[model samples]
Target: MPTLTKPKEHNRERPVVFMENVSKIYPNGKTAVQNVSLEIEEGEFISFVGPSGCGKSTIFNMISGIIEHSVGKLEILGTTPTLARQQSTDVSFVFQEPTLLPWRSVLDNVMLPLEFRNVTKQEKLEKAHHVLKMVGLSEYTKALPRELSGGMKMRVSIARALVSKPKLLLMDEPFGALDEITRQNLQSELLRIWETEKMTVLFITHNVFEAVYLSTKIAVMTPSPGKVESVVEVPLPFPRNEDFRTSHQFSDIAAKVSQDLKF
Candidate 1:
């Protein structure tokens, strides 16, 4: 059995997520990632972009402790990834799809994470309601997932992730399935939530424009048996909008990321 060996107290000197020449190799002798190093600060919104099978999802799984690396150091929130993923610690994940329970009402699905928590029923309800409102889903709390549109369903998923008030949020292409209009709308909504919550976000996206728009920093990776090609900085100020997206700086940054992305 592999047990977690983490620092007794949170190590404030380190970044929120620190990866030192990490690599992931599967039992089948597949090297999904190699020599990937990154340091995410306390409140940054980072987007990772690469082609399919480029190990973007692999990196995410490692950070969330769903899988372990074959070599090198990776820490989340000042501790080992596995330990940081425990309850009472601040980490949450939103998948590429809205994996909600179709049978449950929106509010019930959002409140499920709190079921095992030590909080009282009232506390859970308050937290659920607060997050639902934050995602603009308060009015549809009683509706089932089947009754919601794609965008609304995703909103509920985000609200559910936020219910726990995670300090680090990992989203794997959460808006990838939506139409362009809805995707852009949710992008703005996400920025609003991030600005207020101040959570460190790690996002995965295939779209370069979306990556540049949402990220304070963007990491580009190479194809299969992935390795980070480069880290591109988005120096633009936050509260990004249509104007920022249209600006030359935005295009310049997006082009830089695009150039770094290898086929």
Candidate 2:
């Protein structure tokens, strides 16, 4: 049996993401999220899971400054979300689809972000190549998106996200589109990247098992008019493998997260 490790206490000096009584109401008078609050510390991997229409993606967009919250306070790295986005390379987002440009090579795709910056062409090339290597896609730098498999394309997406060296990475069901085998493989790969990069990750997914497998904490949300019902801790040690996934502790935590989603 794999030993279950207890989660260590975090020093709550300044959270990477802080939300209090945050709510999002669209112009049509529909409430997407209601009074959702969460505090995520540095280097923690947090996953949000809930039923469909639970406002999981809504919360993500709000945090990323794609949209504004209708009420309450929201801050990223002690600054307003908009300011955090404009003044610093503190955040990045990965969506459900890989969203790669079919015409562009892997290297060019990853270099897109840096091209908009003040860096020289050589500097952009170096940064893009570095991140491609980090994501294990260095050898595929010249391949177009159509030439890669689903998993490989997602790797390119991840590399693009990391090219900016952001402090926070937000993913919206990034692996939901892959097959089981590929999904499991990428889940492990993502963990490896997270550990190596040491960035705060906020991942939204519908898979309770994936959430338990990858996250330090799982935030379960209620149905439409989404509110965080509970945040369950996964007190498992790092470098978790297939053995840990099949362990009793893994099943217990997954079941608990499922129960929370049901309520």
Candidate 3:
């Protein structure tokens, strides 16, 4: 996509997600990612912003160990997707869609992931209530998915992701499908959760404003056959509110991100 740089030498402590000179070429010889390197530390919110087909999802998959890299090193939990999953409950992904089962109640849907772990049913129930409350859905615990709005359903999805108390949370455009009002509302809600949970987050978004509002750092990628173009820092203080979004500083940082998305 653009002239790529050499991968950086990383510290041995191994930041939560570490990639060095990584590339992924499919069987048909199509290269989706090229020489990408990044380091994410604990308790940081990192967002990936890029245009369509620019390998944002590819880099995301590599971090989650969903797919392997053809070259260079990726140090997550393990090499294989299955191993990556089996090795940890410390990581969780919240996809764009809520993906709730129709029959389950809101509380039940949130509790489902915990069922797979070694905890007792009582513990699972407790965790479900805790996260549902965290997402401001405590009163809707008994409501069915059909009874909820798009925003509420997504809140359940987020609560489900947090039920495991993960150390790293990877969110893939989790608010992209919502209306403007709902999207902004959820953005505020997410920041609150991040403040309380204090976990590392890796988010993928096409919206520069969203990236600037939620992230500590934004990793901008180039066009197809993606490479890290730049990592823009958001020096804004956290616990941000509506006023922060409307402030000139937020507008300035958002402009920088928009510029990075350019060819």
State the lDDT of candidate 2 residue by residue for 79-171, as single tens digits: 988998888778999999999999999999999888778999989999999998887888999999999999999999999999999999999
Off by over 4 Å in 3: 1-12, 77-82
Steric clash count of candidate 1 = 0
Q: Is candidate 1 or candidate 2 better by TM-score?
A: 2
Per residue, candidate 3 scores C-alpha lDDT tens digits across 36-83 of 877677788989999889998888787777888899877764344446
- What are the TM-scores, per candidate, against the unseen true structure? 0.94, 0.95, 0.92
Q: After superposition, how far is residue 238 of candidate 1 from its true place, in Å?
A: 1.4
RMSD of 3: 3.1
Tens digits of per-residue lDDT for model 1, 1-263? 11111344765466888888899999999999998888788888989999999999999999999999889999998888898887454999999999999999999999999997888999999999999999998899899999999999999999999999999999999999999999999999999999999999999999999999998888888997888887788888978889988999998998888888755
